[model samples]
Target: MASYDLPRRLVAEAFGTATLVATVVGSGIMATSLTADTGLALLGNTLATGAMLVVLITVLGPVSGAHFNPAVSLVFAMSRSLPKRDFGGYVLAQTVGGVAGTIAAHLMFALPLLEVSTKVRTGGAQWFSEGLATFGLVAVILAGIRFEQKAVPWLVGLYITAAYWFTASTSFANPAVALARSLTDTFSGIRPIDLFGFWLAEISGAVAALLLFTWLLQPGTSSTLSSEAKL
Candidate 1:
């Protein structure tokens, strides 16, 4: 339903992803600089990331569906909302954009250009948290698009804000984001060694959500039921 062509859509995906990650990494850096308390720093990071999602999705949804997350894109493709042919381009754009965002954040704070994160975010609990978080994210998107399309941006923003506190992995449900965060050694970073588990968890969660929600929101059954009731 998007009016933009492939090239424009790719640019929107790249630019939106870049800004989203920049907001995330930049805000985390600023939060750490200003606070000694981890709670307060996390609060700042959460608010900024949530706010950016609202803005980005609102502005770019029409052009590219505002899929800054590879998991989200994959789910869309699976649902046929996004063409399978375009899935690879979306993932590539999101990945490169996320990395660029991290670079931008580091340069803004005068930090090293690229530092492999040493933040060890491994273990079963963390991996499970990421899976659950990503599951909720995709579920929200599917339900919101079906029922409250206009409110999708706000729904996502609010969900992530809460997920940050509830999830152990801080809800880095996006594989592109997780990979980019590995380049930063700040409050939001995750070690590169821990990335595989995150990617697996997120993709699994997304696919599960897609299948479940598709069944729940069965388009054919709904209309058929309505017609039978009318008769």
Candidate 2:
């Protein structure tokens, strides 16, 4: 991997996250504008978000491990793949970039730059779906990095694409993205009041994956730990 300083990595994380959230919010707006079918609009949003993940991760992975999601960063921090000192920076950049992404999307769509979302997305099922979605996401990321480093981007993009269809909450597996989405009152938005459940579930799910994969990927010999992934 290329050696980049902390500032560069933060910039990459922010930029990648901004682009990702932009794609998500922008596509949702466009889809709803063009269609009345909810499913079709969701399909459009999913495709754009998935495709952008592939592109963003492919280009920025070397710079910042393409950790556009705070949940992903948290997992890396817990697993010791990411330095403790850098974890806060990563989360800050992701959150700031995510909000900027919402503003950018709103600008393009001629909507308010910031608004409280009225979309009601809450309940036991939704929270559970968020947890399960994030668990699978972190699991895939860890396994991909361990077994196939070069395929991490594609693996993540594809996993999210599938998760979007399989999960009840449409797989808002990313905390930063979820927060950004709440700033928009569009089709992709979630109610701001519902953020706590999503955040709790996402963080818990990521930690769970880390604990499971740490053991699952451990080498047979007790003398050695599981292979360390840089990202």
Candidate 3:
């Protein structure tokens, strides 16, 4: 990978993450505090997240790939698309942005941190949801890199949107994101107790995506890949 401007990448990562977090927190608060139906709140929040994600990726991708989620970074790191030394910076910037986003969400609602709980899935459902969510997210990301390099933002947004509506866990496929989202106990909050289960499932799904992506991208490996591998 060519040298990435650390400052530029950091700024991009921070801003991208911040944008993501802000949307989650802001939308979550709205859903929790205002919406009468829990389902509506979830739908509204995720839809906003999906919209914001697409826009941010389009805007920041040119600068930092708009990897708002660490899993995207991890997959790229595995593929040697990102420098190892920069991973820490990327993660840190993302975390800061997440915190900032959560904080922004809190501030927008004028609520305490304790009130930022997100009411995420738990138990067997949480585990399975994490797996499916991660699988879907990683699949989209890897596919984008391997084939549809041009329409990544739109495709990703569509995937997330559909995942939120179709999947049981509402498709939070990111580990750092899961952790960051957990800090609050609001519409976006996941119980800290359930964190490990979700993370493990998400990791498993991401690894699966890496393997599938590798198999699909390798030439003459049609036996292991799929036509969906096309961008």
Candidate 4:
């Protein structure tokens, strides 16, 4: 809202997006580098990622409203936390920052990125898995901002960890990360062709939350998350 706040928001978005891509790519590389049995690597990455998400949300959430996902930003606007005019700015920052984050990750690892998912090769249970994973994540976030105000940031991380562990799709919830991960043809890559299917599932999940969160989640204050404000 303030003139100074816009730049701060942009910086937060950049930093947060960078952190996300770095964690995914760095962990993916480290995991791949650690021999055949990558279960431990995956576990470590999962925890680190979850923790980073919490930290990022806590630090940047207040500043940027932490709409790290474009879909999240959209839903937030629909839910009225964000101004409609600012939506385009947020989306632009997110998209550019996300792509920049991916490029940074790729450069950091010195890995080759193949145009992997360009032919619609992904199908079957993968789509469903994406849907479920995304829905679970959005549900967690909405619950936080809607009812559990103080718990929102940290819980975001924990929710991510659980999603990775329980969901078939390893819970790549943020579309920013999804696009960034596509840059690297590694354990994280979903082939350029496969991207559409996963994106469709994720978008569906976000929209579902937008439509249903008001009824499903407990009400919260306009400023603080509680049952005080009547929106």
Backbone clashes in model 1:
0
lDDT scores of the candidates, listed in order: 0.95, 0.93, 0.80, 0.74
Off by over 4 Å in 2: 221-231
When sorted by TM-score, best at the front, the candidate numbers are 1, 2, 3, 4
Q: What is the per-residue lDDT of model 4 for residues 133-222, given as tens digits with 9 covering 90 to 100? A: 777777778887667888988888888888887876787766767777776666666566567777888888887866777676655555
| TM-score of every model versus the real structure | 0.95, 0.94, 0.88, 0.85
State in Å the error of residue 125, model 1: 0.3
Clashing pairs in 2: none
Q: Candidate 1 clashing pairs?
A: none
Better of 3 and 4 by lDDT: 3
lDDT tens per residue, model 1, 24-140: 999999999999999999999999999999999999999999999999999989878899999999999999999999999999999998899999999999999999999999999
- The candidates, ranked best first by lDDT, are 1, 2, 3, 4
Model 4: lDDT equals 0.74
Model 3, residue 114: distance off in Å is 5.7
- Stretch of 10 with least lDDT, candidate 2: 222-231
- In the range 1-231, model 2's lDDT, one tens digit per residue, is 349999999999989988998899999999999999999999999999988999999999998999899999999888788998999999999999999999999999999899899999999999999999999999999999999999999999999999999999999999999999999999999999999999999988988998999999877754344344322
Quantify how close model 3 is to the true structure by its C-alpha RMSD in Å.
5.0
Task: Report per-prediction Cα RMSD to one decimal.
Answer: 2.4, 5.3, 5.0, 5.6
Q: Which pairs of residues collide in candidate 4?
A: 116-191, 116-192, 117-191, 117-192, 117-193, 118-192, 118-193, 220-226, 221-226
- In terms of lDDT, which candidate is strongest? 1
Clashes of each: 0, 0, 11, 9
Candidate 3 overall Cα lDDT vs. reference? 0.80
